[model samples]
Target: MPFFRWARIWVLSLSGLVLTGSIAAAAVPQDMQDFNHYTFAVMWHPGVCATWSNAGPACKDLSPAAKINQEWTMHGLWASRPRSLLAAGMNGPTWWHYGCYWYNPEHALPKGSCANPPLNLPEALHQRLYAHMPMAQICLDRHEYYKHVVCFGETPEQFFPKELDLLDKLNASAFTAFIRDHRGQWVARNAIMKAFADSFQVKNADALELRCENPSHHIHELERQGNILTQAWITIHKDKVDAFPAPESLEKGRKGNCAEKIHILN
Candidate 1:
């Protein structure tokens, strides 16, 4: 939720971190759809860049441009539905994969196929963006715009700033504060979720999902132990960005790979 910048680190070789997996196949609609709720994802840049930098053009090679730090960077914003509004009913896939024809039958396009102009945010706005979202590679932004934001019918200009606003709000909260203060330490899941609620003034912990990954593969010698926090998913209603929604009671199996005792990697 919070963000920061640190001294640069030069790497003679990327051999220190070797990622062994492929990027998950995107499960998004190829066409546009209407939705009433949203899922905002904030990624920990160091975690992502550590394993994924060389995976593709979308991933930034942070070895030369970034230094180690405790910050959660913007990933992407997704529009989705509450379980009660799902067409497939509650028994359907709760994973909310976009670009899936079943989800957006009328206009679904293939993932990464949408045609969009450059995300020409104003100069002042770009400065603000660079400050908080420095690690998101241009290719990654383009893919997100096509795969997710395109379905919302808002241009990159309109959609990305909205996402950034949400990230800014969380970055200013106590949830991120807890992460920053406890980097490299193991933390209880309940405590972390509680901090999210307290910081954002939300009432239900279920509205927040903690995402963790293997630090041994995604980070430097942070002394790998249990899973580490890599991302956080929070639900917000389309009509009420000011008010956090109650828990959607979405299936637990659909949640990101996080642990009960999460390690906050630096």
Candidate 2:
């Protein structure tokens, strides 16, 4: 790690800094070593609420000071399988061994480290998680910690804040700004990819992928037309935080379900 980044983490530990709306912390656990890459999944809150609200509790109203608009909300941070293994179909057991204890293909529940509390975090830490992840009935933070973060081997203290920080980074990026500003408009898939490339200074469209949902289907109980942006998945290397691979280099499942053009719901 760079000196400044290392120093920031050290200072945070010594000070036990409080979590806030603007920034969150991330940790690299001693035992849970780095892997092939990481996936930072971000959700469009408006799309989620439109389709999933009735499936769970309504999202909490945001405080006036919260930086998140109804624009983007966090989904989860995931450790991705290496491209080599992915090519060999290392999705089920192999993927779980990396830290996300997924249930076997035939099962509905996962079996692994996340079965219990991953850390002994204080109440304040929990509050910070709740603040950043406000969608209801899901116990979003707890579920994420168990399913994803637990396998990461970081304590709750080290994990939650870091994930929140990643979310903040996304929310502050030009990519998110472009999507939010273009709401209520139909955007071409290429335009979306180009915007991400421009915003992040990534020249390759293969660096990122967008997931869209067809809300017109009654099976999902949403009323939106055509496809709607739901999640943005970005790939990063395990050791380096910002290293991105071309989209073709990503796992096969990264591509989302969308047509040539999709509507950006407000």
Clashes of each: 14, 5
Best by TM-score: 2
Model 2 Cα lDDT, one tens digit per residue, 15-108: 1222111122244333234356667777776566545534344345433233444456777777765343355455656565433333212222
Lowest summed lDDT across 10 adjacent residues in model 1 is found at: 1-10
Q: Give a tens-digit lDDT track for model 1, residues 111-210.
A: 4422323455678766666566654345456546655554334655566677777776777677777888886677888888788667655574666777
What TM-score against the true fold does each predicted structure earn?
0.65, 0.67
State model 2's lDDT: 0.56
TM-score, cand. 1 vs. native: 0.65
The per-model lDDT (C-alpha) reads 0.53, 0.56
